[model samples]
Target: MKRYGSIIGVKPEKLEEYKKLHVAVWPEVLAKIKECNIRNYSIYYKDGMLYSYYEYIGDNYEKDMQKMAADPTTQEWWKLTDPCQQPVENRAPGEWWAAMEEVFHMD
Candidate 1:
């Protein structure tokens, strides 16, 4: 398993709306994530910033991600979620959510 972390900003005005939508994510979207081999997925919000963590269990991360991207339900889900976000200014190239380096880990 590979652990990943990333960060993005939530537009202040859209914070409440974003939080509301997450209360009941569509079942199809959830299934797509599992089908792509992402597990232990979670998103956290704090001070206008959103952080995400997930473990990738697939042999090919990029391939699995592409598979997820090709799903129509996932695309529609992003259409709803993307508007509420602002990518971090210092994010690395090609990063929508800034990839975070793990400096420490316990078990």
Candidate 2:
């Protein structure tokens, strides 16, 4: 499995709405994530930033991501959550959340 981490800024005014949405994530969205070979997925909030961490078990990361992106359910989910997030400065082209480098790891 490969570990992935990313960060995006959350709108302070919409923090509550964002938290509420996560409290009961849609079942279809969760299934789509697992379907794409993403495991141990979690999103954390701190100081207006949302940090996401997940493990990818798929052989083709790009292809799996593309699959996820193409899902209609996932697209609908993004329509709601995307508004509450702001892409971090310096993110790579086409990145909604800035990818984070793993400087060190254990286990």
Candidate 3:
């Protein structure tokens, strides 16, 4: 499995709503994430930024991501959640959340 981490800023006004929405994520959207081979997914909020991590268990990362993107439930979830995020200015082109490098890991 491959682990991925990403970071994005959150609008101060929307932080509470964002947290509330996450309190009970839609079941269909959660299922879609698992269907696409994502596991151990987590999102953390700190200092006005949101950090996310997940393990990709699929052999084809790109293909799995494409599948997730195509899921109606996932698309709908993004529509609700995306607006709460403020992507970093320097995020690479085509990236909504700036991907992070894992410099160290153990266990």
Candidate 4:
């Protein structure tokens, strides 16, 4: 499996709503993520920073991500979650969640 991590910012005022939404994620969106070979997914928050981690078990990573992005359910899910997120100042252009570099791992 390939591991991935990303970072985004959540406004302090909207943190509660964001946590609530994640507590009961939409089933269809979850299915779509699983269909794309995503597993062991988790999200963490500290202060106002949100970090997401997941493992991709499939061979074709690009295709799987494209499939997830093309799903209507995911688009709808993003509509709700996106508003709760604030891109960090250092994030690259057009990036909502900045991709994080993996520095170390033990297996």
Candidate 5:
């Protein structure tokens, strides 16, 4: 499995709303994520910065991501969550969340 981490900025005021939405994530979206080979996913927030971590167990990462993005349920979920997030200034073009560099690891 490959581990990935990403960072995004959450508007301070919308933190509560974002937490509320995640407290009961949609079943379909969760299913789709698992179907796409995503596991052990978690999001953390601190000082307006949100960090997302997940492990990809599939061979085709791009394809799986595309499939997930195409799902209507995931699309709807994004509509609600996207607005609450902002890409960090250093994020590359076409990236909503700044990809984080892995500095240390143990397994």
Candidate 6:
């Protein structure tokens, strides 16, 4: 499995709303995540940033991501959650969250 990490800035004013939304994530979105071979998914909040970590078990990461993105349920989910986030200044083109390099891992 390949691990991924990313960061995005959360608006301070919307922090509670973001947290509340996550407390009961939509079933369809959760299913799509697993359907796309994403596991151990977690999102953490610190300061003004949201950090996401997940493991990709599928052979084709890009294709799985595309599938997730193309899902109507995920699209509707993003409509609610996207507004509470701000893309980091240095994120790659088309990235809503700035991907991070994993310099070291021991496990």
Runs of candidate 3 with Cα error greater than 4 angstroms are none
Q: By lDDT, is 1 or 4 better? A: 1
Better candidate by TM-score, 4 or 6: 6
lDDT of 5 by residue, 4-82 (tens): 9999999888899999999999999999999999999999999999999999999999999999999999999999999
Question: Model 6 has how many clashing residue pairs?
Answer: 0
- What's the lDDT of the predicted structure labeled candidate 3? 0.94
**Per-residue lDDT of 3-101 in model 2, one digit per residue for the tens?**
999999999988999999999999999999999999999999999999999999989999999999999999999999999998998999999999999
List lDDT for all candidates, in order: 0.96, 0.95, 0.94, 0.93, 0.95, 0.96
Off by over 4 Å in 5: none
Residues 12-107, candidate 1, lDDT per residue (tens digit)?
Answer: 999998999999999999999999999999999999999999999989999998999999999999999999999999999888999999888898
TM-scores, all models, native as reference? 0.97, 0.97, 0.97, 0.93, 0.97, 0.97
Error of 1 at 58 (Å): 0.8
Candidate 5: worst 10 consecutive residues by lDDT? 86-95
Question: What TM-score, to 2 decimals, does candidate 3 have?
Answer: 0.97
> On lDDT, who's better, 3 or 4?
3
Q: Which ranges of candidate 4 are over 4 A from the true structure?
A: none
TM-score quality measure for candidate 2? 0.97
How far is 95's C-alpha from truth in model 2 (Å)?
0.6
lDDT of 6 by residue, 1-107 (tens): 99999999999998999999999999999999999999999999999999999999999999999999999999999999999998999999999999999999989
Clash count for each candidate, listed in order shown:
0, 0, 0, 0, 0, 0
Comparing 2 with 3 on lDDT, the higher-scoring candidate is 2
RMSD per candidate (Å) reads 0.6, 0.6, 0.7, 1.1, 0.6, 0.7
